[model samples]
Target: MSVLPRTPPRVARRGRAVPVGGVLLFAVGGTAATIAVVWWVAAHTGSAWSPGGDLAVYRDAAQAVRAGGSPYQVDRDGYGFVYPPFAALVLTPLAVVGPLAGYAIWTVLSTLAVPAVVWLLVDHLTPAGDHRRPTLLAVGTLAALPLSPIAGTLLLGNVNIVLLALVLVDLLRVRGPQQGILLGVAAGIKLTPLVFVVHLLLTGRIRAGVTALASFVGTVGVGALVLPADSVTFWAGVLDSSRTRPPGEEAYGGSIRGAVLHLLPEAAHGVWLPVSVLAAAAGLAVAVWASRRHEELTAILACAVTGLLVSPVTWYAHWVWSVPVLALLVARTWRRPAHRRWPAGLLWLVFALPLPWWVGYVLGWAPLTEPAWMMPVDLLYTVTAVALLVLAAVWLRRTAPAARGCPR
Candidate 1:
């Protein structure tokens, strides 16, 4: 008789399975609550409250475009234009609907899209056969509700969410031809997202980078062709306006640059250029490391999120990109035993603590003039960026050996 080989005792499965039903209930409840709160605020605030300053500018530009007037030539109190002609063209339809209605529709759609996008990013990152789907789903919901920047985006009626979605989707599907088109669309809407072009280039995705550049050029070319004479006027006006406007006049309160200036009052107007240059250099360094390390998509996503925060001009709503970063944090932590839970908890706290502050600011409950207590917002942003960089550095250290295997 052949002796049967003794099987090794199965190790106890680590981490608990998430409850799907509970996650669904929390998501639905949280979404409903968020909508209700926003609607109430909008109704109560009425004309006394305006969306973020950027929204006002965009709305005016939309109206200008719709009135058979050129947005490029229309100087709103000498506030120079920054957006391209393509933005005005896109806003034409919204202008027809009126700013309030357009803002309402955008807020609703963006708020709903936040969780779905977070879920997609998380699903893409997590390994298959993990029994942590419920935990991941719950985490996604929390991210969309608490830590994510959707609240501020909705409250401010900002376009950052749409730009963010386009950028995230482009990064997620960087291998596709459509990535170039999407990147172009994002850059056309908001110029800052153009940084991704550099990211694509440094990664040796030369064809994709070229395609992105071509798409951007084609977009501007078409816009110029359509607007023709007005395009030149608009470009000139924007450059002049951006230079002359002071921070207070520009309503820079909610941006990283504004926050920094708020905390360090001495640097007020002069900090933007230096801060922008430093952010660019840091971003380039991170992108180079990511390329050399052959880092995972999650690591790349983290880099992108960190890059945004480091930028001097980033606003609170733009933090919506952090949803994916938080998702990655949760998914990674969930895979390990209970003893490894601190990182996940810290991530959640960092993501959650700022929601109330953002909401308070948007609602006018937390004015920027209230002494230096407001400095925490800037500090929090700085901490978040540093943490993400640390995470990427650690991951790079671990993957360096594996990445060396690729042919030089």
Candidate 2:
């Protein structure tokens, strides 16, 4: 038998060099993009904002713990400590740092999360050996960082990025005993992440769901043990009231509740609760369908959007979900020609542009005291969330003939 000629060692080495080159390119690009975005944000946002505004709640609460005071009694500028008491325990270390130092550390961490999240999304959706993956990730991070929601997250020092990391890392992991603990702790810190527990259940990740529930309860128990009176007031009273809605926050909040309350007369405000419930139910069903189809990204997006829409208050800062949505849309449309890709482009433009300006313009003409902006910019977020849920529903239904029947 004739032996096939062996490839030259030089040729094999050249093949190896290409991917190493790709890796190096990725590292340099990612680092450069992250630095540029962070610097731009810092330079533009002069020191006019409240130093550690949202973070102050945690820091102040932690300082209270240090002072042997109750965290629940803590209120910074009329915004009481809304998070579970366990979060105060977690944030106690930051209390040691001065305000400016804490703000700097928090900003840096949130800034880093922007690129890290973008990288994770691109890495997940893009296939291995695609030469464009690293470049796309770096470029996408650059593009996403300046969007209004992300900008707001950084400026306000919100915990949404940390929350996003907890959910995404848990979702990306292989099924295991330790899978949902982080998510549970995240929910314990902020109640919104509990929706992911529903996601875990819908996806048939029963063990993970249980672990998450247990972890969440563990936080509550820890809080009760550490400060029983504060725990009682928070769980019993503070959690489900207008008090949890911060002062003047309705104008900035973008939830369905906010939109409905803005759109309708004062007499109709009560209608928002039922409407929110229905929207959440429908959204979760769509997430469940996405899960059944193994569309993990779609499912996560659906659940996150649902949580944002249904939450009593979702300020622009809470919309860290938009980053993943934009990245996923980019990954889907990158290979398509420009002519066939306008839908993704349109969505990206809607997000990437300063759509917040529209909100401002509309509100200026018809102050939120008047509801006319709802016809224009006021309902923009609520509408976008509904559209995404519809898209997820359509995607799941169209992909599987057996699943065409409406989900209950």
Candidate 3:
């Protein structure tokens, strides 16, 4: 140490070490670029863009709440506002801001929060000495960002990102009473996330499942107690609308069911419901089997993604939620030293290719196209969805047993 501090052995390297500053620059630069692009698209498109219809709906609901009207009571031309009143109450502050400002704030928060939540989940899953792996996981997550439907979701002002973060956070915790409470809260915010209760049951976490159900029921009870007559009216209206809403109006891109129907005009749209049910059942069975044999969070997430895909009403923007699962799969697959690089390469391709298709749709290229051009895009969509599903299945098969034995 007296002789020039002995040239700290760790600093003596044969190759150039990665500069932390450079890494930070890259991350910040990339995020900035992405934000700029989305902002430009949102600003220039203005009211011409229809992809963010959900955002419009949310904004409208917020306005209604601020106007001393029940969001549920306000008839939104057939797409009745069905979200819990608490959601509108929470969004009241955002409503005070104009739509553009509110959307911008929401987009930034969602984009930033999602990755951070994923990192936390990964950290929880990894072993003590494996802390370094979470950074790799985060990088893979970033790489998959382009594929995230979050762009569409953000543009549309969907609350799914927050719902997704809550679900993922709940899943990462060891199955317990508190986990149930988290699950309940997420489900109460958005009912679809309630599917995780079934997942817990399938995974043999009966106590957790019961707890989640109880929490949901408790929340509902509280809502009923506070809102009373309004709660009943909301439930009735939602049920009526959900049962009777016309097709095409509700179907958005990104759902496997919707995508398949959009791709196959010859097929009856009603077929989608049955097909979706079958797909969901099959996916659930597979997920349960995987969980029983391997217990990997990625596998469970893949199942959840599959369920969303098979659901009849899922929109393209909701697909952003799958990006984290896809990223985790890529990271795990890449970790296998002997594995060929093709899988990773293919993953990148799948992640990047569909984005242009979405852009094309937004630009009205697909709708304006002749049958020939439209057919190809539809075919491509079907192929990509199938490919992603197959890849998820393969990953689940590979990671299940290892995850089962993993000390969480």
lDDT of 1 at 60: 75
Question: Scored by Cα lDDT, where does model 3 land?
Answer: 0.61
TM-score, candidate number 3? 0.78
lDDT, ranked from best to worst: 2, 1, 3
| Highest lDDT scorer | 2
Task: Name the candidate that leads on TM-score.
Answer: 2
For each candidate, give its TM-score against the true structure. Answer: 0.78, 0.82, 0.78
**Which of 1 and 3 is the better model by lDDT?**
1
lDDT of 2: 0.72
- Per-candidate Cα RMSD to the true structure, in Å, reads 6.4, 6.8, 6.3
Please list the residue runs of candidate 3 whose C-alpha ends up more than 4 Å from where it truly belongs after superposition: 1-25, 48-53, 73-80, 121-138, 237-251, 256-270, 335-339, 357-400, 403-408
- Candidate 1 global CA lDDT score: 0.62
Model 1, range 255-279, lDDT digits (tens) per residue? 4455556566677568755775675
Shift of residue 71 alpha carbon in model 2, Å: 2.7
Residue 157 lDDT (model 1): 66
Please identify which of the two predictions, 2 or 3, would achieve the higher TM-score against the true structure.
Answer: 2
Q: Which residue ranges in model 1 land beyond 4 Å of their true spot?
A: 1-29, 46-56, 72-81, 128-135, 237-279, 302-312, 337-339, 357-375, 398-408
